[model samples]
Target: MGIKKQLGPIEIIVNNASVFDKLGLEEVSAQELDRHFAINVKAPFLLAKSMNEQLTTGSAGKIINLNDWRKARPTRLAYGVTKSALTGLTRTLALSLAPNIQVNEIAFGAYCHPQIYPWVDHVRISA
Candidate 1:
């Protein structure tokens, strides 16, 4: 694939990069939605597929994807939907690249608020 040829010997592939869209389904513009998918899902998929090409039989490699724990909430529907798809991609790729490559996803939830994060700290998770 293009990735393998472009960047050979990718020992570890970290699907850590992501983009968030705040708009609800009805308010989300086509361009914004496409950008979300491009960075969140498509990039990771291409990288994993490319890394699989470089991996040989009996060789070991890892692909880890960072996902959101708040994906079930309707407020984050667009972002959550894409992350859900990413989770599916992780599982499917794990099966396809099994016996040589290990693929996994991690879901995170917390209350750390960064300055750039637009989400208000009004919502609280009670467990």
Candidate 2:
């Protein structure tokens, strides 16, 4: 869809949309897993493929993948695997698009638990 845009070209793509469900794997259905992969993995891959031509013309285009500690957790099997694939895609793209585009991934740690607790006296997490 974006490739057909008259914006000339796209220099940067950030794959950041994700769904984080705090449920056990058994409780999560196949459809839910598919939805996660559709957004987190497939969307980015398709976007990158569609923009390959535009990206090749740029000197230093960038594709940044947003990852998180959840990717390493075993509990969220589907989310973790999809995110892991995204990280791998990031690395592969970095090498594949070299000399023209740059691919990078930034992994973030979970901070909401200890920070969002309203009953704990943990140093005014909100402040």
Candidate 3:
């Protein structure tokens, strides 16, 4: 069965996929940066674009992008840059898709598995 037949309609999209590869300034390669952009930024943009019709068909729609609170991370240069770009994309999409779809970003702080992300010390959500 097609997605429409199974799910009815897509009302909410949560973009949570991200890459946090550790790379220093000198270690960051062109391919690495492109990979980060392709997954972290382009994927979400394309998904939203492709689902625009379905999203706007409903009375209300929401697109939420998961982002990191830290603006800069020297340990993961390319990852940080792509995340920053995602923030801009969220803000721009919100204005562009107004009255139909609501685009927002949830910034997380130091939240990751200890083994996967040894750099992250703790996870805290604050108002």
- Top TM-score prediction, candidate number: 3
Model 3: residue 16 alpha-carbon error in angstroms:
0.6
**Strongest candidate by lDDT:** 3
What TM-score do all the candidates reach, one by one? Answer: 0.77, 0.76, 0.82
Write candidate 1's Cα lDDT for 19-74 as tens digits.
77567767777787788789889999999888887777667889999998777656
Better of 1 and 3 by TM-score: 3
For 33-105, candidate 3 gives per-residue lDDT tens digits of: 9999999999999877866766535477789999999858798999989999999999998998887888999
Give candidate 2's error at residue 15 in angstroms.
Answer: 1.2
> If the candidates were sorted by their lDDT against the true structure, best first, what order would they fall in?
3, 1, 2
Q: Could you tell me which 10 consecutive residues in candidate 3 have the lowest summed lDDT?
A: 111-120
Tens-digit lDDT track of model 2 for 20-90: 76546786798988987898889988877766775544356778889885575455777887888888888
| Residue pairs in clash, model 1 | none
Q: What is residue 16's positional error in candidate 2, in angstroms?
A: 1.1
Local distance difference test scores for all models: 0.81, 0.76, 0.86
**Best-first order by TM-score:** 3, 1, 2
Off by over 4 Å in 2: 1-5, 56-59, 112-127
